[model samples]
Target: MAAYTGPGRDTLSDVLDWAVVRGGAPSVAVQVQDGDGTWFDAAGTADAATGEARAPGERLHLGGISQAYTAATVLSLEAEGRLSLDDTVERWLPGALAGNGYDGSRVTVRHLLSHTSGLFSTGMALEVQRRYGTRAAFREHRYDVWRREDVLRLAVSEPPAGAPGERFWYSTGGYAFAAAIVEAATGNSFESEVDRAVVRPLGLTHTFVRHRADPGYWGPHPRLHSKMFFRDGVRPEDVTPDNWPSLLEDPALPPLDTTKANTSWAWGAANVVAPLDELIVFMDALITGDLLPEAQHRAMWATESTKGAHWLAHTAYGLGVYELTLSDGRTLRGCTGASTGAHALVLGTPDGRRTLAAHVANDYSGFPVFDRLLEAEFGAPGFAYDR
Candidate 1:
């Protein structure tokens, strides 16, 4: 009922502080809900220059986690008889994936949601990486707007990762096609569909689409930071997890403030923003069948193997969500999201009786802080935090 006033809630603050003080995050916020009640806490500075403490209410970027919402919207359309998961991308958007060794006729809606479509990630293209992947490139194109067609074109121009349904290949470009299919089927923008199916229905006041023209958060939020900036001749691929710890401590590349960058390049894939508590409610409603019908809800967790996805250890990909096997071997479902300067994770039990939501205001991927936090909440030994 009160912030940090529930069972096992007392230690969350320490974990958050550890993330900031030791894990190289500028700020971290976390919220948990269970039979004991709800608890909230935050640590580190929201604005490093001002030494402002992080607040539990700050709106944080959801990043790729937004794909879950988009996927839910697609499922809602299916529930309404507007489309089917088996429907080929070609069925709705003719010739959208016909070029560059792609055959949309074989790429189904399910393939896109489960990351088995084998489509190349436009966001990971060399051109995009050179333009916006690193801190130096980000500064150059911070305000540039990338149209949907422009982004998708880069995907098809590259060779496919493999045949459709061959294996897990994470791709934001695939979600772009999914969003286009949504519009093609409903004759409405993907954002509008999400509002109708998830946002408005759940009364999520803090959550909304991050428009291309809007280059910053609408209200109070942490000043996002990243250590992705490196000296010239350093490639994005060189920033590996093995070196990330040292990089975080590297004096030459102190965290760069990336708070004001445009997110239009990730529109349908990673554009939602919400505070931790609202995100918890959204994820809970999703798995608990509050936002979906029985059949669709069942379909949400019908997971596909993530063997080659290089995702979290002991995990599998599902429709708009992930099936994570914890240290104790208990399965939980949720999504992890990241962008230039923010990261978030939301996971809950199938019954929706327990949930954990966390946000870090630095752009490091798959940090150990989340693993420690999950262990504290679930009474587990630990999770496989390795990337």
Candidate 2:
């Protein structure tokens, strides 16, 4: 629980300092666990206004990492024989994906979990883009609440990304639909289902879901910051692809404090929050087969190639997790979550012997540092930088 001065401690500190001093992050916190023990470290400020330092165990939005929890819940349901991975969307939520050229019967729970359902993301809808895509729109509508039905309707308003299982289209709408299916199959809220499946079983004291109406963190946490610049004279439409780089580098502007923004738009799919340490435990349990039955656990890590999916570099999509390949050609299982101003990642070896979890108070750009940090800790080259 003290400052890490073990192997690679200096290298980790250098990267952490770089992230805050030059990488534009307000703060960065990282925790790593292995056979020796657990180590935690932080750099930069937790609150920009207060100049408070970031610390380990500080709760932050889990972002896309919530998909792993949702995935676990659905798999547990399958383990109970209440549902099947191959169950069609229509089997549970009868006509939800029927419109927008989507055949609900053609999409299965597995497809949704693996981002292969081909459902167009509600977050990518033109209307959504016009309203919340840019910093200006975000500032203006940060507090707006979106209902579950509203998100579903927005999703089907667009055409399918591809036929089910044909392409890897990363869609939060897919997870939302999966959450809806979980509700129909269990007759319970997604949060309760996650609690039953992931939280309670793993004894995670700090992890919980963020409801649509809630726009704040539950306990002590760092202030989330984002680089979605919102200048006074500029409109959302004005920040185009060609000029965003220049705008991002303008040192005169401060990052936006998105800590208070409502995340209902991607609720259920990316709403879970927890401290970094608890996240490591949950991820390790999930990876080590402590949370699901043998067959289901195997299925959870049965990652397929994301050749055509909107995936990260050196990563492939699993049921609700990611299989990240390192430079050594070894792969690890993990998940990533991001809210407006925060980004989080949980990565571990397949056997769960070693794990690393990190949170950044800036946008996802802070992720590249993980590659170096991982190598420094685990003795393997990471994907972020070449040695």
Q: Which regions of candidate 1 are displaced past 4 Å?
A: 234-252, 380-387
Per TM-score, the best of the predicted structures is 1
Lowest-sum lDDT 10-residue window in model 1: 240-249
lDDT of 1 by residue, 1-387 (tens): 365476556677778878877877878888888877778788888887899887766788888999999999999999999999999998998888888799999999999888889897556566676677556677889898978777667668678988999988788888888888888999987778888888998998888877667776677898888776545565655554345344333454667788887877776788888888889889999888899998998888888777645456778888889888866678888998888888889988878999999888877633577878877777644545435
Per-residue CA lDDT of candidate 2, range 106-212, in tens? 99999999888888755656656666666778779988898888877776877887888887777888888888888899898888999998899889888898877
Against the reference, the lDDT scores of all candidates come to 0.80, 0.80
Per-model TM values vs. the true structure: 0.92, 0.91
Candidate 2: stretches off by over 4 Å: 2-4, 229-252, 379-387
So what's the TM-score on candidate 2?
A: 0.91
